[model samples]
Target: MKAATATILVLATFTLLSSGKKFRWCTLSDLEQRKCAELSKALLAVLPLATINSFARVSCIRAQNTHDCIDKIRVNKADAVSLDAGDVYSAVKLYGLTVVAKEIYEEGNCVFAVAIARRGTLDIQRLRGVRSCHNGARWTSGWNIPLGFLLARNELLWDEDQPLSQVISQYFNASCIPGVGITSPQLCALCQGPKSYVRNKNHFCETSSSEPFYDSEGAFRCLKNGVADVAFLDHLTIMNGTDSDQEEYELLCPDGSTAKLSAYGTCNLGRGPGRAIISRHNFQKITKKFLTLIQHLFGQNGKERAKFELFTSVPFRGKNLLFRDATQHLQLLKDKAEISHILGLDYVALLKGLGHEGSSLDNSVVRWCCISNAELRKCEEWALNIKSDPLVCVQAASMTNCIELIKSNEADAATLDATHAYIAGICGLVSVAAECYGEGCAPAAGRTKKLTHLADKALPPVYAVALAKKNARHVNIHNLRGRRSCHSHLYSPGGWLLLSRYTVGALENNTVNCDIGSAYQSYFWKGCMPGADKNLCKVCIGGGEMEGAKVSSRCAANHNERYYGNMGALRCLVGSPSGRSFGDVAFLEHHNLLKNIESLQSSGWAMGYTLNDFELLCLDGRRVAVTDWADCNLGPVPPNIVMTRPVTTTKIYGFLMKSQETLETNLDSKFHLFHSQKYGESDLLFKDATQYLVHTSHLDYQSILGDPFFQLAESVFNCTHADILEFCKQDICTS
Candidate 1:
């Protein structure tokens, strides 16, 4: 009888104590559970002395595991509970949840929601009637937080130890009680702790018109259903929108009918709040550093505050597991200015070839920097491969620095250009498979054109931002002002034709050539740090980005040694003082072809250097007339050193396909031309006769075109070495 009477006394005290207008929870929910557990002995330092019994059990739930506590609360076993925000619907269709409004706990990770609806979907006058159908209610992250916020607004309190019926009666208007309906009690009960719940529908609720609806999601649905004249709420929904559902919402903010949004209001206010707590023992033993770290970590700015839900799947804490909802590719799109890119290697060439045909390809490609030599072999085998899309690899690189260059706009667009894709691969980024200019291009600075390996069908054109042509006409000249002009340094068609022309045109043909080298070097080390660590692999050095310069310098460094040859930067021909000549460098190097051909033009001088680079010296104007040199014989007569040399156009292009190979066979081909030849060695090598002519296969011309042994003429051109080589050989030699 004394125990029963004691219980009655306890209950009576709680009732009378909670009846007044003030209700500040002395004890919170989630924290109380740990204190009750014997396992948390040392950690539960909050235990009060003097036999203080906490009759008011906090109903707070820190996580789903706290549902057991919520169950105890529902059966009158405990006082109140706390929960996080996961129980809400955050999908495309944001739903409305009718929950108790009490602000118990808030933090960066989770916040207690007061209420939410699609933007502009709620009416202020109609907010009182929602959830009139529930007997008792369930809770979510801050069902209690919101309750506290609102009840505090009206300066009311729930009668303590009283049924919720009696508690709510004191706070709510008499008429509002009969109309109260809860969001989802069943789901709320089932989702015990900090889980989220969607109140409205499968899709997010839309605000229509200028009125505040009681239940955000449902109010919007009600507005759409025409039950209400206007709907207004929060959740970053459109303050103004043009979409179908957007038309239904008309914003109602501060100052009643005024259209402007004074504050983000409920949308911005209910965000998670931060608090400082540690193990009770730790709290008593707080170090300044620990407090500082916590303050820094939970601060109101930076990535920690971003609170990206789906992005947090992988905790970035050295866990080797990757979690992504990759089931739907298109659904991942966000309404932000972001671009998804594709980056890889030589494979980008294939993507680009496809783009040249006016087909839709990837939006962009990195560069020909990602393909490994081994991958090149695989590419050869998968020449016609439709399964291994280069863009897919490019997409993978978009995840990091591996993606080299990227197009400016669009958050989720796919990059299709192979060159761009390869650059992405080198940088380690990811993007979707794009069918852009880089799509069909090889990851390497491979074929500017398509390959016979792939099938005939051309790739589709990639879509990109299109500006008015009229605007382009006036602004075309300003394009390079602040742009980074780039190209391979060693001579090639791309380097020569486009880059050289641009350089020569910009800087003009200068004698010192200082500006010319400066311009090209700008591309070399501008983005590169001085004494740049060789972060890039040689395999990525096709067409001599840095390799061409390095090779020339190293070889020039050692000239007298047995194997010490000269400039590997070019192919050359030695011209004798007697006006006779013989091939010096291998045909593949072709520097000599460009070097001294013009020496024989007007004066026929055994000149030291012919600095006139690919100038249109001899032109009929009908087409371009050049001294052809690819496959044609060094034409007729007694080896006149200054006479225009002949070459083969078609065969040279074919040879180019085989020229850059590092194989011994290709090496033999470079020397075979010098070896099988019949010539007086000294006439070309020196003014004297009979030197090393009768020895091994024609004095390996590769060695003869020494860095300093240039007895002929040399010149620089405004075309990539490949282009100049192909242009002169095809146009001049094919004749």
Candidate 2:
């Protein structure tokens, strides 16, 4: 009778003490559930000491998988669950769950995914027919990060209409991606299932341990057994899996180089976010507080660690039971933190590319911005012809206006010169592709050879040259202090920036503060600089004036200014139909130097001038033939780039690539992507010399423009109180 009374009194006291909120933790498997139950018992023992107003009771809820846990949390059946970074993306994006805490490892809240292969057996660049091993389907370190890196580098091309698995299966000879099952048999070819397939059941590609090659360790074992060429796993797994013969295996870097297994910090595919604990949106605060309290009691440095270990799964005989064993502690996140902030913009973009959030490539019409009517007409014609991937033409008055339009989302993309590309990047736009000229897209071996490889293969840099008539013997590069000059535009890379850097910025007599415009005005005689004011516009001949009429098009930077672009500047030095040349020297790009001279000869503007009539003024005070621009040019200019809003970069690149592929395959198509002859113009929508467009999404404006040019641009534009810089600054502030 006395014992029964004590038991009843204890039960009543327990019911009264546990009157706080309850935290229901969702578990994926039976082992995880058992771990959770132990955790609950440990929390109960510390409830009096660690009690918080938010949560004082702990409960365990079982789910079949991560997706089921996500659903259970959404319906209020569970309060929280720990998930991998890749699964966290789906939970936040698809289910609208909130991340309350993150698992911080020894390397902080991120892990590096590395590619391992036998030394000298594989290269990252040559993975076409190589056998590959992955941790699991849609896993962060194994499947997503490495494959996403490949797609970003243009090594893999995927059509959004089909599953990404199909593309992966076709790209590799064989792969072992457990959980993918028969959907991609090629991906399951190397996975080892249970010994008894018919009697014990077929677990060929299960995500569970039934499949021998399932997680990071299994994937590495697949490589160790000589069945795979490369194994994609996390750095921790690689470190744990290697033995005394670890020197025999090497890491495959994204740059096509190999490194020792210990160089994972620098040689890896990508840095991925750490696993996180997620909860329903309304349960975030409670979950965060509860997690903080429990972690303090049973974490790595827990005060009550003698009673319970929260991070380990040794007793459960499992790996990563409730949380990753590698987790150092649980980091509570700020209320405003989102998945994108945790996963980072590039990784979020990669997940989107994998069709997790949505299809990166959409059917929406891409709006291509055109600054002039000629370009608009050409764009409309191209759009009409390429009906499969639709394009809408958006007209703007100038390149600056096009930048504003694209920033405001009114326009999708526009091709801009190197100078304008810099301004666009400053205005929050990104480069997706760049124009490739000459024989190919690869950098030429030497200046004498236009291209060592075929055109359409890579992007070749354009050369800037100073052109002068061969008949002018008195005027040379050294004595051009007071000579009339013609420039493509105010801040054009080849025409103005490079030319002024070597002249006004170099000469002791012409050196002023970093004011390039003031230096140009004081150094050069009356000349046409298009966008400059006063004496700079004195030699400009408007489009109407070129036809022997007077108009306001004089000094305008567009086509209205007859002497505005490379060809226009060439026309300024080549003389009019009446044999009256306005400028003594012209600064332009060398790619179209011969072509522009030929076009001028055919148009009767340079009746007496042949290719030999013009010569290049070398910076060393020596004159050479125009064909010798390889050694006599001002500097090598980067090719024009296609700029767009950050969100539409991949989409616009896909549209343009598809359009180019269509034009290449259809020989009888009337539209010409590079040529502007049909429009009675030269370089309308794109440069007339542009052979093709190469994907440059991996590079930024600073990288695309090269270090020397970028530095020169900063000195020329940022140093001066120029109107373009002021406008860009204002745009940035407003944006």
After superposition on all C-alphas, the RMSD of every candidate to the true structure, in Å, is 29.1, 10.0
CA lDDT, candidate 2, residue 506: 30
On TM-score, the candidate that comes out on top is: 2
Candidate with top lDDT is 2
lDDT (Cα, tens digit) per residue for candidate 2, span 171-192:
9999999867577889999888
TM-scores of all candidate predictions against the true structure: 0.19, 0.66
* 288-348: candidate 1 lDDT, tens digit per residue: 2222221222223212324321112233331101111110110111122111111112112
The stretch of ten residues in a row with the least summed lDDT in candidate 1 is 637-646
**Alpha-carbon error at 40 in model 2, in Å?**
2.9
